[model samples]
Structure formats: structure tokens, C-alpha cells
Target: MQTQSVQKNNVHKKSRSSLSVYLGQWNAPVVGYVFIAPWLIGFLVLQLWPIIQSFYLSFTEYSLLDAPHWIGSANYENIAKDRLFFNSLKVTFTYVLASVPLKLAAALFIAILLNRSIRGISVYRTLIYLPSLIGGSMAVAVLWRNIFGTDGFINNLVVLFGFTPHNWIGMPETALSTLIILSAWQFGSSMIIFLAGLKQIPSELYEASSVDGAGPVRKFISVTLPMLSPVILFNLIMGIINSFQMFTQAFIVTEGKPYNSTEVYALFLYKKAFGSLEMGYASALAWILLIIIGIMTLLNFIASKYWVFYESESGASK
Candidate 1:
């Protein structure tokens, strides 16, 4: 009887202890949530609400001055028929396609070079990264515009080389190309990511490749490429997304000038929203952009299975 009683008491104690531990764990999560409540609330109020409202507004005909009237896909239909819309879409797609690959390639190349053991390497990294921090700013956009202007740095360089100075910014053929170059100039962030990915690659693999009589190019192709595939994939996605959403530089620099040569989708949307006061149409455009980005991301994920490498997972398994 005494032994049974003692055992029961121990069981009761264990149950209480377990309950206390569970409560403690629960309290920590609650406290953490409480701490993060402000940010959560802000995201819901600012981002989530705006996204939901925009989706609803897309089906309507709304101007800021008046109540929205539901038009039932009229905005989407109009967008299909709109010449400017198609032009902007083409321009935006061109920009994204051209800029992202070039930019990423430049970044990866620079990253590989900088990954070597060199004196004051940190300074070189900082210098390269500085452009990314500044390139997206209004000031930098203005500077770019000036540099490409008729009487600007580029034209002056042409004059020095005994060539006739040409209008750079005012020319439709070259204006968009200038923007592409600008986009490529800000490759520092991608380079940093590539550097990080390079660091994660094991040095032993390189040694093994060397022992197998693999040259630099062969080693890069066989070992480095496979190991860095994941990072390459990441940079590709991010670069594509960012390029698709490019706005500030074009907005400040060209303002869709030279016969709409630089008129990207985002700028077109902005013009519709604020300039023409077509809120509903602008909202539809936003939704379309969101859908495009989603589709692209989905496609990338699907394609990644064939190329992207996981440390522990086989390609066939993926």
C-alpha cells in the first residue's frame, strides 16, 4: 500500500511539472507575438488592406473624386486594346530580360575576382557595392541623365575622340540602352550574394578537381558551377523580380520621353493612376503585374529542379 502511494505521488508531481513546462513554452510564444504585434498590425493595415482594396477596385471605374462604379472587366478589356499598354509591356519585358542576365553575369564575374586573396579586398568590395546604394536614388538618376545628355560627359568624350557629339538622352534608340547600362552598374548586391555563396563552397572539392588534372575552366564548369547553382538561381529570381519592378530611375531621368521609348509598365501604371486619375485601370494594371511576377516565380521554381543543387538532396529526388 505504501509503495503504491509513493508511486502515485511521483506521477502527480511529473504531471504538474509537465504542465508547468508547457505553460512556460506557450507564454514565450505569446510574449514574442506581443512584441511583434506592432509590425504585424502595420503589415495588415498598410500592405494587406491596400492589396485587397486594389483587387476590388480593379473591377470598378474609380476616380479619386467620385464613388467607384463596377464595370465588370472593362478595365482589363481596355488594357488589352490599349496600344500604350502593349508598348509599355514590351518595353518593360525587354528591360527585364536584357538587364537581369547581363547584371547577374557581371556581378558573378566581379564576385569571383574579388573572392581571391588580395590586399585590401574589403575596400574593393566596398567600392563596388557603393554604386548599388546610390544608383537607385533620385540624385543618381539626375546625374545619369546629365551624363547622357547632349552636352554631357558622354558627348564630351565623343568630342575628345574627334567625333560629332550626338544626343544620347533625346534619342529613342539609345535612351533605353542607357537605362540598361545604369541597371547593370548597380550589381554590387548580387556580387555580395555570390561572394557569400562562393565562401560556402568547400575548398576540398577544388583540391580534388586539381588532383584529377582539371584546369581552371574545367574545374569551374564541373565543380564550381554545380556547387553555386543554388545561389545563381537565387540571384536570377531576385534580379528578374527587381528588374520587372524598376521605376525610380526611369521616372526621374527620362519621364518616358523620346516618343515613349523609356515608358515602362510601372511608369505607365503611375501615369494612369495619378496623371489621368484612372484609379480602377491602375489597380487592374497592378493586379496584372502581380500575376506576371507570380507566374514567373512559379516557372523559375519548376525549372530550378533541373539546375539547382541541394547539398544533401539528389536532383532526381527533387
Candidate 2:
């Protein structure tokens, strides 16, 4: 009886040790999965699922009121002849090309000015960044519309300067330009990013360039630009992406008015999806936009080989 009891005790101890080993091996992974589960689930449901559905829906006619009818490639074929599609694409390209450079230039300029060591610098940054905080809101867009209206502040200010009052957002020729100007005005985010990049740059490089009799422009060209190239690449890609996806300001301010002059790709997509309820067609447009953005990003990266300097690759020849 004693021998049997001792064998049972040994078996119990062995089982407990095995159980502990298993738990120990899985503990970290289990915790990690638990932590990531929320984000993973949200992404799968909100983002990934919608993407897959949109791709599938692109091949079918799906109105909210009815079932999705399989009409393979019809939507894409229609898109080939869609005049509005072409027009919106043109407007979007113009906005992206024009606004991005202007925005980057403004951001870099402000960043340089703010990078100075002086009293109340933090306050200045806060004040400057304040515009970006409200830039994308509906209220801001409404305010912008009011500001550029016929009897608006802009016209009033111009009238005071002995100029004829013109409606900025009323005319087709100037409508898209107003949106572009608004885009450039909201450069605070990019400015902040540029400022951060400037902060990371080594003062030693500037001092060395100064010792070599390099003036401000020469140092900026040689030392500042080379060091800031990576940051520029990052900002440029982000600006392009954001500009391509711009909708809120255009929607609230212009609503693609004055002969669809400000009809950007996103606004057009929204109109197709919701206004006309051409779900399938809108889905195709969305996919095409994704492809375009992807191609542009790839091209940027490919071109960046010549311009985007990395500190880690300093020893490598261009």
C-alpha cells in the first residue's frame, strides 16, 4: 500500500511539472495575442474586409436597395468612357502636383524660421500649429467658403487695397486654386514634422560648413538638404497621399461646383457611391485610385535613390 501511494504521488508531481512547462512556453505569446487582438479584430473587420468586399463589388452592380448583380468588367468598361472620371482625375492630379510642392515649400520655410533659438519659440510653434488642429474640420471649410465668398473677408480686404472684389471660389478658373491655396495654408502638420527633422540634424555639420566659408544658402544646399533628404522623402510621400485623398474641404466648401472644376477623385468617388448609388462603379474607381497611389509611391521610392540620403548609407556611393 505504501509503495503504491508513493508511485501515485510521483505521477502527480510529474503531471504538475509538465503543465508548468507548457504554460511557461505559451505565456508570452498568449499575452502578446491578447494585447493585439483588439487592433487585429478591428483591422480584419473594418479595413481588410471592406477592401476585399470593395474589390469583389467592383466586378458587380451593387446598389444599397438591391442585391449585388454580377456584371463582370462592365463597371470597368464604363469607367474607360466616363468623362467625369477623366475630369476628376485631371483635377486630382493638378491638386496633388501643385498643392504638394507648395505645401512642402511653405512647411520647410516655416520650419526653418521656427528652428531658431529664441524667446517664446514654443508659443510661436503652438500658435502656428493651431491652424492645422482645425484645418480639416467642417467648420473650418465653412469658414473658408465664407472667407472667399463675394462679400467675404478676402474680398473686403482686397477692396481696401484698391483692388476690385472678385469671388475666389465662384469662378471655375479660380475655384480649384482656392482649394489648392487652402491645402497649402494647412501646412502646419508638415511644418511640425519638418521642425522635428531639423531638430535631429547635427549642429556639428553646420559648424563645419561654416568653417569652410559656406554661406547660409551654400550650407542649406550642401549640409541641410543632404541631411534633411530622408525627412523630405517621408513628407513628400505623405503629402501626395493626403492630397490624393483630399475630400472634406472640397466637399464642404465647393461641393465640386462652378462646372466641376474642383471635383477631386475622392469627391467624385463619394458622388458615385452615395449620390448616384453606383456602388460597383465607385468600387472600380476606388481600386483604380489605390493602384495609382501605389504606382506613384513606387515611382517616388525608385527616384528617391538619387535624392534620399540615409545616414547609415553615408559610405556608399550614389
Candidate 3:
């Protein structure tokens, strides 16, 4: 009888322990969801709902006034035939391709310079980063227009140098390039990231390379480049995404003028939705942009596996 009683007690203890463990596991997910509930709700309401709605609208003809009429693939078909759509796409592609590499390179160079132990380095860093904060504002865009205007600072400088003055922003040929330069000038945010990445790299690696008779350039190429590849990939992807979505600078400075030479994808979409009252078509354009960015980011992630070396994993294997 005592043996049976002890066996029953052991079974009860095991059941209790199992129940407690199950409750603990359930509590964790509950707590995690509670903490994330606000963001999740906001995302669904603000971001996800709009995206889904836009996808549905992309197949319809809705002018934000009347009921939406189902148009199937008509919008996509029209985009293929539209010359302005092609022009806007060309302009956006040009900006992304031209600006991203130049901006990232400039950022990396400045970051390297700032990473050095120099006097008043914090002041220099702050000054460099200030442009990024101010450059995206409407006021700065107005300032950019003045700086590149026909009778503005650039032309004045050209005249001072004994050259005939030419319209910079007023000309279609130079207008887009001016915006590209403006974008490159605000490389501070990327520079800050690069500086942080540079700091994270172990100094011992450089020392070891130097001990092996590696020069500065050689050390950079062999040691620093490999370690910084992940950060570079991150910056490259983000820069491309941001560059592709550039709108405000061109919108404020050029107003898509000079025969719509500066009408980027975002501006084109805006004009379609607000200026022309074609919200359905604008939704299609937004989806297309999203797809392009998604594909590019995916390609970058796939490519990074070959080059990006994580210290923890790579060093462990070595």
C-alpha cells in the first residue's frame, strides 16, 4: 500500500512540474505580444492596411471622389505605353545609380578621416553631419535653387572666373546633376555609420598586418575591407533605396520643370495622384517602386553571403 501511495505522489509531482513549465512558456509569448501590441496595431492600421488597399486600388479606376470601377490589368498596360512613365522611371534610375555610389564613397572617405585621433574631431563630425539634418528640409531645397539659379552663386563664380555665365538649374542638362551633387553633399548619416563600423574593427588585426610588412593601403585592402564589408553592404542597400525615393529636393527646387527633366518616380506618382487626380494609377506606380526596391534589397542580401564576413563566425572557423 505504501509503495502504491509513493508512486501516486511521484506522478502528481511530475504533473505539477509539467503544468508549471507549460504556463511559463505560455507567459513569455503573452508578455512579448503585449509589449509589441501597440506597434503591431499601428503598423496594421497605418502601413499594412494602406498597402493592401493600394494593391486593390491598383486594379481599379478610383479618383478619390466616385466609387472604384474594376479595370483589371488596364493600369499596368497603360503604364507600359505611357512615355511620361518611362521618362520618370529613367530619371529615377539615373538618380539612384549616380547618387548612391558617389554618396557612399564620399561618406566612407569622410568617415575614415574622422576616425583618426585629431584635435576638435567632434566639432568637425558635428559640422559634417549637420548637412544631413538640414538638407531634406523645404527651406534648404529653396536655398539649393538659389545657389544653382541663373543669377545665383554658381553662375556668379563662373563669371568671376572669366567664363560666360550659363543657367545651371534652368537648363535640363545640368538640373539633374545639380540634384545628384546636392544628394552627395549630405553624406553625413552614412559617414556616421561607417565611423561606428570602423571603430568596431579590432586594432590588433591592423597591428598584425603591419608586423607582416603590410603597408597602409595593403592593410586596408586585406584586413579593413573584409571586416567592413557588412557595413558597406548595409549602407549601399539603404542609400540605393533612399536615392530611388528622392522627391522633395527636385519638387521644391525644379518643380519638375525644364520640360519635366527632373520628374523622378516619386514626383511622377505625386503628380498623377494629386495633380491629375489619378489615385489608382499612382497606386500602381507605388507598388512598382516597392517591388523594384524589394528585388534590389534581396539581390544585395544574396550577394552579401559571398563577401560579408562576420567576426564571430568567421573568426571562430579560422
Candidate 4:
């Protein structure tokens, strides 16, 4: 009887221990969920819901006024057949192709210059970066429009140079170029990233190059380029991605004016959604844009294997 009582006591203790452990395990996840609940809820309602809604709406004819009516792939069909849609694609492709390379080059060049230990370097970097900080704003876009306008600062400078003052944004030939230049001018973020990459490149490599009788140009070609390859690749991909979304500059600066010469794809999508109240069409366009961006990103990654060299790989090979 005493042995039976002892066994019952042991079983009771074991059950309590198991319960405590189960509760402990449950408590941790519950606490974690509690902390994450707000962010999870916000993401689900705001971001995820809109994204899902857009996907669903893409198949339906949705205008803010009426309930969305389901139509199957009609929006995509219309976009493919639209000439203006093609024009927007052309403009956007041109911008992405032109601006990204130029921006990366300019950013890298500026970063190389800034990498030097100079007096008031931080101030200079700040001044240089300030434009990019404000570049996306409506105010900056207005300033850009004014600067490139017929009687604006650029024409004023040209007038001083004794040339006929040309309307930069008024002409088709110069309008897209002006936008490309504006995009390239906002390379401060890229410059900062490049500067950081430059800093990471070991000074020992430079010293070793010098010991091997390498001049500035030779060392730059051999050491600097290879060392900065990964950074260049990173900046190139990001620049391309960002350039594809070119909108505000085109919106405020040109508004796809000069015969739709500057109508970037995103701007066209915006007009379809808001101006024409073709929410379904716009959603379709958005999905197409996402696919295009994904393909481009994939291509970049594939191409990186040929060009992007890592220090780890070098170390491993050696």
C-alpha cells in the first residue's frame, strides 16, 4: 500500500513537470507572437491585403465608383495591343539603359575622389548627398522642371554662351536626355555605397601593388577594378531597378510631354489608374512591371557569376 502511494506521488510529480514544460514552450511562442502581433497585423491589413487585392482586381474591371466585375485577362490583352503602352515601355527601357550605367559611373568616379582623406570631407559628402535626400520630393521635381524649362537656368547659361536658347523640356530630342541627366545627378546614394566598399578594400592590397611597381592607372585597372567588382555589380543592379521606377521626375519635370517622349511606364500606369479610372488595367501593368523587374534581377544574378569576384573566392583559390 505504501509503495502504491509512492508511485502515485511520483506520477503526480511527473505530470506536473510535463505540464510545466509544455506551458513554458507555449509561453515563449505566445510572448513572441504578442511582440510580433502589431507588425504582423499591420502588414497583413495594409501591405499584404493591398497586394492581394491588386492581384484579384487585375482580373476584374475595377473603378472606385462601382464594385469590381470579374473579367479574365482582358486588361493584359489591352495593354499588349496598346501603342502608347509600347511608348511608355520604350521610354522606361531607354531611361533604365541610359541612366543606370551613367549613374553608376558617376557615382564610382565621385566615390573614388571622395575616398581620399581630405579636409572637410564629411561636409563635402553631406553636401553631395543632400540632393539625393531631397531628390524624390515634389519641391525638387519643381526645381528640376524650372531649371530645365525654356527660360530656366540652363537656357540662361546657354544665352550667356552666345548660343540660341533652346527649350530643353519643350523639345522631344532634349526632354528624355534631361530626365536621364537628372536621374544620374541623384547618384549620391550609390556614391555612398561605393565609398563604403572602397573603405573595405584592404590598404595592404594598395601597398602590395605599389611594391610591385604599379602606377595609379595600372593599380586602378588591376587591383581597384577587381576589388570593387562586387560593389559595381551591386550598384548596377540597384541603379537599374530604381531607374525602371522613374516617375516623379517625369511627372513634374516633363509630365510625359513633348509628344509623349518622356512617358515612363510607371507614369503611364499612374494615368491609367487615376486619370482614366482603369484600376484593373493599372493592376495588370503593376504585375507586368513586377515580372519585368524580377526577370531583370534574375538576369543580373546570372551575369554576376562572370564579373562579380569575392574576396572569399580569392582566398579559397589561393
Candidate 5:
């Protein structure tokens, strides 16, 4: 009985020691995780859960009022057959292709100007960036509508310049273009990025080029473009992704009107989900958009190997 009692005590001591050591090993990390538990729970519950649920819903016919019926790939198949889907794709692609380059160009130009050490530069930058700060808001969309409508700012300007007054937003050909211009108008974020990129470039390169009898334009082409390529590539990918998801202005300013010339993909998905109560179809569209965005991002990454230049890599290669 004494031996048995000793054995029991030893076993209990070992178990306690093992548990204490284990707790000691993980104490800091466990506490750290405890502190972050709320964010983790929120991410899992709010963001990840919904994403996974949406993916599953894409495969099923789910109206909020009814049970989710297993429909397999019928939703995806319907997306292919739907005519408005095609129109949405066309309009979205047009907006992306048109807006991105113009926006980048405008941003780069503004960034170059802002990079200069001139008086009231901060105020000018703030004033210029003010449009982007208000961009995509309902107020901005309404203001944009007013600016391009018949008897609006554009028409009034045209009349003042001795040209016939015209409705910029009323015509199908020009409607999408007006939105593209609006997209370009919010070039502030891209401009800030370009400004940062410009600052990263060493002044010595400019000096070296100047010594080699290169003019400002030539220096910009040789020195600026190659160094700034990485920033440009980043901005391009982001712009493409953002442009694909455009909806607000299309909904507010045009409502996909003027012969459906501005029926963007996101607006179509939104209409499917809320407007038509076809949640399953909208989920399918969302999945399709994910695939498209994934493909575009993949393509950009693949193409980046050729165009995106890093100074460290270039220096090492040289």
C-alpha cells in the first residue's frame, strides 16, 4: 500500500510537471492569440464564412425565401448564355481599358508636377486630390450627372465657346466615355503612388544623364521609365481590379441607360442579387468575376517578369 501510494504520487507529479511545462512553452503565444481572438472571430465569421457560403451558394439555386436547391453548374451555364452578361463584360472591359491608361498618364503628370519644390505645392496637391477623396460617393455621382447633362456644365461651356449645346450623358457613344473621364478624374491615389516612386529614384541618375548630354525628356525616358516600371505595374493591376468592380456611377449617373452602353458587370450582379432576387445567379456572377480577376492578376504577374524592374535585381544582373 505504501509502494502503491508512492507510485501514484510520482505519476501525479509527472503529469503536473508536464502540464506546467507545456503551458509555459505556449503562454505568450496563447495570450497573444487571446488578445487577437476578437479580430480572428470577426474575420472567420464575417469575412471568411460569407465568402465560403457565397461560393457554395454559387453552385445552388438559393432565393432567400426558399430552400437552396442543388443546381450544379446551371448558373454558370446561364451566365454564358445571358446577353446582358456579355454587354456588361464589354462595358466593363471598355471602362478598364480606357480609364487605366488615361488615369495613369494623368497621375504621372500630376505626380511629376507635385514632385517639384514649388510654392503652395501642398495646397495644389490637396485641391487636386479633393476630387478623389469625394470620388465614388453618391454625391459625386450626382454631381457628375449634373456636370455632363443637357444644359449642364459641359453644354454650357460648349454654348459659351460658340458651339451647339449637347447632352454628353444622353448619347450612347459618349456615356461610357463620360464615366471613363470620371474615373480618370479621381487620379489622386495613383498620383501619390507615382510621386513616391519618383522620390525613390536617385538624383544621381539624373545628374549622370545630364553629364551625358541628355535633355529632360531623354532622361525621363531612359532613367525615369525603367525605374518607375514597378510602380506602374502595381498601379496597373490595382486599376484593372478596381475598374472591373465599378458600379456606382453606372447605377446613379446612367442606370445602364442610353441603349445599355454602360451596363457594368458589378451592376449586373447587384441587379441579379437584390433587384431580381436571383441570389444564386448573382453568386455565380460573383464567382465568375473572381475567376476573371484571378486570371487577370495571374496574367499581370506572368507579364511582370518581363516589364517590372527592381533596382537590386537589375544591379545584380549587371
Candidate 6:
């Protein structure tokens, strides 16, 4: 009886060990997929599905109340003659052209200032980044509206300086400028990215340049700019994309006021999608915007080959 019981126990242990080994083999192959299942499902359901639907709907007339009807390229044809479409595109292009460069410049400048090794620098960075955290909020938009209003804080400051208080948001010429200024002010994200890039730059390069009697301006031009070009390209593309899609501030603060001077493309798309219920037209616009962004990004990549220097490429070439 003892011999039989001991053999039974050994068999049980062997079975358990074999089972565990099989499970380990299976888990090794499937664990990564299990972890990524949520993201994959989300992409398929929330993003890829919507993108496909939008592309299909862009070719059809899909009012919310009725079934989508096939319309071929009529929407695109109509867009060709749509004055507001042109206006919104013009405003968006102008905003992208102006705001992106300004924002990147400001971010780079602040990053350079903040990159020093000093006490409480993190606190300073946090304080500066705070605005960007709340920058897109409705409250911030309202606050910005008040600041640029005729009798708001900015006007008070102008009065103190003996300059006449002007309605910044109410004017066509200056309305977009205020939005651009706000965009530039929310440069904290770009600044952080620039700081990261700056940290990655080899100090040996700077030392070598310094030893060669390079001045501050010379070192920056020779050493800093070349190494930082990739970061600049990244920031530039992101800035262009964000600036082109700017809507909340324009919607809440200016409402594309003073003869639609500040009417950005996204705001126009919003009006078409929700306001007029022209879902098909809006989808077409969205796709067109996507195409425009893709082209711009492609152009940036083409242009980058001329200016963007990679350390790996340099090493490989040498």
C-alpha cells in the first residue's frame, strides 16, 4: 500500500509539472497579444472603423435624419465654388504659417533658457507648463476673450501705457493675431520636447567648438542648430498640424467674427457637421484636410534631407 501510494504521488507531480510547462509555452506566445488586445480593439472600433465610414460617407450625402445617398464627386465640385471654403482654408493656412513658426521659436527660446542646471528649475518648468494644461479649456478661451475685449485687463494695461484701448477680438485684422499669440503662449509642450533634444546633444561638440574659439552665437549656429534640426522638424510638423486644426479658441473667443476673418477650417467643418447637419460635406472637408496635412508632412520630409543632419549618417559617411 505504501509503494502504490508513493507511485501515485509521483505521477500526480509529473502531471502538474507537464501542465505548467505547457501553460508557460502558450503564455509566452500569447501574452504580448493579450496585453495589446485592448489597444487593437480600440483602434479597430474607434479609429479605423470611423475612418472607413467617413471615407464612404464622404462620397454620399449623409444628413443625420436620412439614409446616405450616393452623390459621386458633387461635394468636391461644390467645394470648388464655395467661397467660405476658400476663406476658411485661407485663414487656416495663414494661421498655420504664422502661428507654427512663432510657437516653435518661442518654445526653443524658453527651452534654451530653462535647460540650465539650477535649483528649482523643475518648479519653473511646471509653472510655465501650467498654462498649456489649461490652454484648450473653455474657461481659458473665455478668459482670453475677456483679455482681448474692449474693457478688459489688456485694455486697462494699454490705458496705463497711454495707448488707446482697442477691441482686439472684435476686429478682423487683429482677431486672428490674438489667436496666434495665444497659440504661441501655449508652447510648453514643444519647449519640453526641445529641452529633451537639447539634453541629448553631446557636450563634447560644444567643448570642441569652444576650444576652436567659437563665440556663443557661432557655437549655437554651428553646433546647436545642426544637432537640433531633427527636433525642430518634429516640432514644426506637429505645430503645423495643431495650428491647422485650431478651433476651440476661435469658437469660444472670437466665433470667427468680424466678417469671418478668423474662421479656421476646423471651425467651418464643425459648423457644417453639427450646425448645418451637412455630414457628407464635412466628411469631404475632413478628408481634404487630412490630404493637405499629409502633403505638407511629405514636403517637410523632402525638405529635411537638405537641412536635417543625423549623427548616425555622419558616422556612417565618415
Best by lDDT: 2
Between the candidate structures 2 and 5, which one is better when assessed by lDDT? 2
Scored by lDDT, model 4 comes in at: 0.92
Stretches > 4 Å off in candidate 5: 1-23, 27-32
Q: Count the backbone clashes (under 3 Å) in each candidate.
A: 0, 0, 0, 0, 0, 0
Candidate 2: which pairs clash?
Answer: none
Residue-by-residue lDDT tens digits, candidate 6, 214-271 = 9999989999999999999999998888888899999999999889999999999999
lDDT of 1 at 61: 98
What is each predicted model's overall lDDT from 0 to 1?
0.93, 0.95, 0.92, 0.92, 0.93, 0.94
lDDT (C-alpha) at residue 187 in model 3: 96
Cand. 6 TM to true fold: 0.94
- lDDT per residue as tens, model 4, 41-108: 99999999999999999999999999999999999999889999999999999999989999988998
Please write out the lDDT profile of model 2 over residues 1-318, one tens digit for every residue: 999999999999999999999878887978798899999999999999999999999999998899999999999999999999999999999999999999999999999999999999999999999999999999999999999999999999999999999978989989999999999999999999999999999999999989999999999999889999999999999999999999999999999988999999999999999999999999999999999999999999999999888988876753
- Candidate 1 has a TM-score of 0.89
Candidate 2 lDDT score at position 117 = 92
Colliding pairs, model 4? none
- Work out candidate 1's RMSD over C-alphas: 5.7
Worst lDDT run of 10 residues, candidate 1, spans 309-318
Q: The CA-based lDDT of model 1 is what?
A: 0.93
Deviation (Å) of 286 in candidate 1: 0.2
Candidate 6 regions exceeding 4 Å error are 1-32
Off by over 4 Å in 1: 1-32, 315-318
Q: Write the per-residue lDDT of candidate 3 for residues 198-276, one digit (tens) a residue.
A: 9999899999999999998998899988999989999999998998899899999998878988999999999999999
